[model samples]
Target: MTQQGGTWPDDSETVPLDSGSAPASFVPKSTARRAQSTRPMPQRVGAGAQSYPDTSQFPAQPVSASAQGGAYSNGAQYRQYQQNRQYPQYQQYPQNPQYQQNQQYSNGWQYQQYPQYQQVPAAAPAVAAAPKRTHTRKSPKHGFLALLMWLATAGIVCIMAIREIPFGIDGSRWVPLIAGFVPWLAIASALFLLLSLLWHRRLLAVVSLVCLIFQVVWHIGFFVPTTSLSDEAKQAVTQTDANGLPISTDKYARIMTFNTTTGKADVNAIINEVREQHVEVLCLQEMTEGFVQRLEAAGIDNVLPYHIVAELHHGDNGGCNGIWSLSPMQNVSGDLVEVDASRVAAATITLGDSQVRFVSVHPSSPTRGNQGIWGEGLSSLSSLKEYDHTYVLMGDFNATWDHANFRNILGSRFVDSSQQSGGGFHMTYPANSKIPPLIEIDHIVHDKGVVVGDMQTVELAGSDHRALLATLEAQ
Candidate 1:
């Protein structure tokens, strides 16, 4: 190999090189002699050996003859040399079990074996289940319907309580006038309570239940039977004849009371009803002179022969009253009551050996600013309870059991025939109007000694009120 201009020889040159005599420019002048004697020259092992620069000055490293196809021509010697040339720091680490086997490179380079990896199976795709369906009841308009029902029930209960106040204390004619419809109010309260429950309103249902309970407790008497019959009255009712028919008894009497509606009620119907029912006593209110003539023409005298009629006073407003009896009647009085004399007629009727005082009653209605006169008329009848006679009072009292004034007339001595017979809610007023009768102003009232077997109201044509009929037995 030749050096030109201080440059080293070419690596492709195949010449015996001496490392001891290197270029003077690359080696320092001071250490040149010492380096030459101590460092050995790198020698080519074969003809195919690569020419490399001598690294003897660093340290003598064993050469791999396999790198140049020298002593280890089959690669065994080169692999042994590589295994022995491991670094001291890395020698403490054990060889990986996977690398225990040797691997040959394409260029004859041996290396540690690497473990083959197996692919892991992918996870199954996630799946979700469908949700379950459930049925739910929908609330009625979010309790709005129940709220309305509760309000209605509450209003009815409140109105009924207000209307029950006596006319004398409250001084409201309208309140007392509508008092007869209290039974309907009680019914409506119960109906609203049921509706509130159906609508699923918790608060409204509770309130409506309370209102229903109050109304039922307050007005239960009107629906339930309260009358108790005496022993003599029971015997008279249960007594039968040999032919398996009820025997006619003088102790029993069929009484009917009607308001003629200022002579507008059908006279023929009234006569037919008295004849068919075998009425013993017939009391008539708003009895005009012309109405009496019509009754006579309709054969009312044949049914009830004995009679007493009151004369209508000025501004009476069809207040004239009359009474007719099948039996003989005497000791008649028209001025016994303290109110207008024309409004009431009283007489004594002979029933077998016993005598019964009968009165036809007609009071001024609390309409058209006649509240004061109406109250006075009802109040005057309170005196009748003080009398010793067993009285039978029947006609248009223009009041109901709800009226404090009318109840005062009863005064523990008299009982209404409808109540005595357990006839519930016998509405008899406004019978022939556009609206069905809502109040019972006409009634048959008798002394406590009398027992009522049956009581009912009959529809009368051409009249605003129905006729009340009662079967009474004297105890």
Candidate 2:
């Protein structure tokens, strides 16, 4: 057989060879191409595959070794084809020119080379945070309570000021009347001060404190002793007079003054007090003829035989005044106080070698339409200071120490026996009444030269005024 194109011709011709060799088989080239087409195509898988042509359009099928030639018969040509079908070497992708250089983007999506953001640690869970607390508003009641406390404090301060300064504003009668209740007012101010502190009111507390301080400084002396005195010295009686009454060679005398409520007082109570206290001089206001008769019948004369009673007219009511003394007494009613003589009974008595003029005074009360008369009567007593003798003025003046008019009557020469004795406050008026006595309208006032001791008050039935007793000695 002849060879053409390096392939054996398919003419069914046979070539003689050496004896004893078997016949060899050959696969035609067209059949070999059809077999190769049915095999699976190998696909390249990365950027390197872009340069190769795709062979996926060919259908795949399985081929057996018998259908194709055995592998060793065409191994050299098959290895040459494998070497030609190798995929292109892998290459890196090309970068876009726009992305190569830094540029700003209008759409806010440009790939900019920003500075590296610091890596933040993971946050703890929200459950780890503390919860918030809600607050409630204050009620209006608290504000209203504070307001009432402030108003009370203000009122207390005003009252204390009025009592202390004694402005006597508008010439109003209420000025003197309000002054009488200053002690109670001071107590109210203290209560207000405590309330202000509890309520946390700064202004109210300050005002209350100031007012309380003023009251304590001004009135504390009334309750606390200003002078010290021994019990024996206060009650010392050096001698007895011929009338069996107590007297002292040092010119000491025990005296008492009482208003009998228009002769309604129990005469036995007054007599017993005078006897027990050994009072040398007893002055009486609102004296009546019937009261004088009752006192005489009660044997008041046995203890104090000397007496000078103002003559009472038939219609005199209870305007008369009288004085009874253990020692001899001379009437000085006209010589001592000529004004309101009927209401003021004056007498001079000898104590040891000294002469003491005693006056039982009853001033018109400061009732409505009577303030003028009351003032005149209190002013009239000021003339007593002009006398050279030691004077002891006692009885119901219808005025308290708080009254500006009463203090003026005291002047510089005279002082209240209660105050001079350091006996503190002794309220003596409105006795034997539903309400206890709240003011010291009955007082014993003497010259400053007189040494006063052991001032006291006694309550007697049926009398509106208490009996004020004081021990006096001439200096």
Worst 10 residues of 1 by lDDT: 111-120
lDDT of 1 at 335: 59
Model 2 lDDT per residue over 117-177, tens place: 1122344676756767865454588678767867776766666666555322313566656
* Predicted structure with the largest lDDT when compared to the true one: 1
> What's the lDDT for all of these models?
0.67, 0.66
> TM-score for every candidate vs. truth?
0.66, 0.66
Error of 2 at 61 (Å): 50
Residue 281 lDDT in candidate 2: 91
Q: What's the C-alpha lDDT at position 353 in model 1?
A: 58
Q: Which 10-residue window in model 2 sums to the lowest lDDT? A: 85-94
